[model samples]
Target: MKEFEEPTLSADAVLAGLSLAGRVRYAAVGLAGLTVALLVGALWATEPSLPLRTHVAFGGIVAAGLGWAGFAGWTLTRRVPLFARDRVIAGVLALTFSGATAVGLVLVAATRGGTTAVLTASATGLVLVTAALALLVTGRRRRAELLRRKAALTGR
Candidate 1:
């Protein structure tokens, strides 16, 4: 009688299987990395705190950037042509998301008041903006991809 064991895969080979779990894991890692960077920046950023206008501006930028990231990731992974014009959009989206998170950290740090209000508000805003933009971008990318694929199949 003999016992056999499955061979282990190399790190690179294992990584090649960017399945749903892997993708999600990578995305999470990306988000976490961005958050840490932003926190550091906020800790170091100077001044009596950012104005409301700055918050709004940064928020908007974040939304746009996250939206783009979602869209680009969706398009590329799904092999969609909707946003095939440029890969820069994806990079921009990533940058914006990181910037927004960092600015939020600065705002939180600058708040003279306790973190109760700031933490709750920032958490809510972050979730809403991130989810909204990401979903919107993904939805649009999927729709566009479907349409393109359908057209190609039907010779439309």
Candidate 2:
């Protein structure tokens, strides 16, 4: 008997996946642009009349964070599988943001301006930071799960 072979799919059938992928990509691009715009606007809206030392410190923090972001991106791209990279990055970022927010809240409470009115915001910020921490934990779990699935798929 002749050996059986796999049937080939038609061109349209093979490549017709994700009809709205282009739209999704376009929307992602638009969203990314908007995020950048909002970030720049927030940075620009900083009070120019603030103390020179505060401005310098803010600049240093921004520079360091940007450098760290770049390094993280490089590490993710080189070391992470494409499918898991996003979750890994999101997890790492969420932890960092949550930790930073927690520190900020602590500092605010230690400062003289930590009145009850201002502390209301501290509660909200804390809640968000807690949620972010939860997200980070979930993302890490997802990454682990994905790794296990991949290993199983490869029979490793």
Candidate 3:
């Protein structure tokens, strides 16, 4: 489909969206960089080598980075309202759920300390990683498609 510009979009509206989008974009970049840095830092600090157990946590960090970047980029390319006041609500909801899940996971690990619990945690982490990858891939595809449409329209 051809991309359509919003004729009613004001200068202020454009600025507002760019401002919000910029913030999210910067955040995503920062997160991804930090995750990579931390992984590298851990490796550097290790004397000989790190254990496989450590890689699991690193995987989670990488997943989080990818997910954050994907979502943020997706937010940036979308209509302004998607990243404006409404986005604050979405952010809060996301934070609440994520925080609760982390707490629950911790509690579960603490209360049920055993090989089974470890395995369960590992499984959960893998699931989260998979989900994040899904988000990353889909977001990239959607944004690319959007840009392709926009470019086609503008070029004509």
Candidate 4:
């Protein structure tokens, strides 16, 4: 019986894996987030009688959204070859942000006696955290696989 063999991948093919469509999607998401954060920040700043907690909430949203937009922009502009490391970094950021948001939502729900809106937001947060975790695991696996392929190609 013949043994199974992995297909060879060229460096160009590897580099081309990041499609233009994907880059455009990332840019769109980053721009949208930046726009939303700026708008919300402006409104938040102008609200003179807002509660302290509301201010904090708005600030958190703005910070998190900006962070996401900045990361996306950085990912799109970097010239150095990441060799799948970017995916890992993105996954980590996503997980951290989503996990924090989830915990905050849960706390808010607790403090507010679990109102429907708060509970719904908490559920959404949990879903995001779950998705982030999946991303992290997938990224790690992809990085490992790429490294292994690199080692094989280089006879290391």
Taking all chains together, each candidate's TM-score versus the true structure is 0.30, 0.55, 0.37, 0.79
Instruction: Give the candidates in order of lDDT, highest first.
Output: 4, 2, 3, 1
The TM-score, computed over Cα atoms with residue i paired to residue i, of candidate 3 is 0.37
For candidate 2, give the lDDT. Answer: 0.57
**Shift of residue 12 alpha carbon in model 3, Å:** 12
- Which of candidates 2 and 4 reaches a greater TM-score? 4
Model 3, 30-111: lDDT tens digits are 5675677567556645634655545554555555555555565555566653324334433443454355445456556766
The residue pairs found clashing in candidate 3 are: none
RMSD of each: 14.7, 7.0, 11.1, 6.8
Taking the tens digit of each residue's C-alpha lDDT, what string does model 1 give over 26-141? Answer: 47645654565455445435433777766565556445544644553554365323332333444445446655665665576557546776776567667656765665576567
Candidate 4's TM-score = 0.79
Model 2: per-residue Cα lDDT over 3-27, one tens digit each: 9999975433443333356335534
Clashes of each: 0, 0, 0, 0
Off by over 4 Å in 2: 1-4, 7-49, 52-80, 112-122
Worst 10 residues of 3 by lDDT: 81-90
Model 4 clashing-pair count: 0
lDDT of each: 0.54, 0.57, 0.54, 0.81
1-156, model 4: which lDDT tens digit per residue?
999999996653565445688688779878977987999899998996998878888888898779879877887887655577778987998898788788778777777765786778788898999999999999999988887877676688
Cα lDDT over the full model 1: 0.54
Q: Any runs in candidate 4 off by more than 4 Å, and if so which?
A: 1-17, 114-124
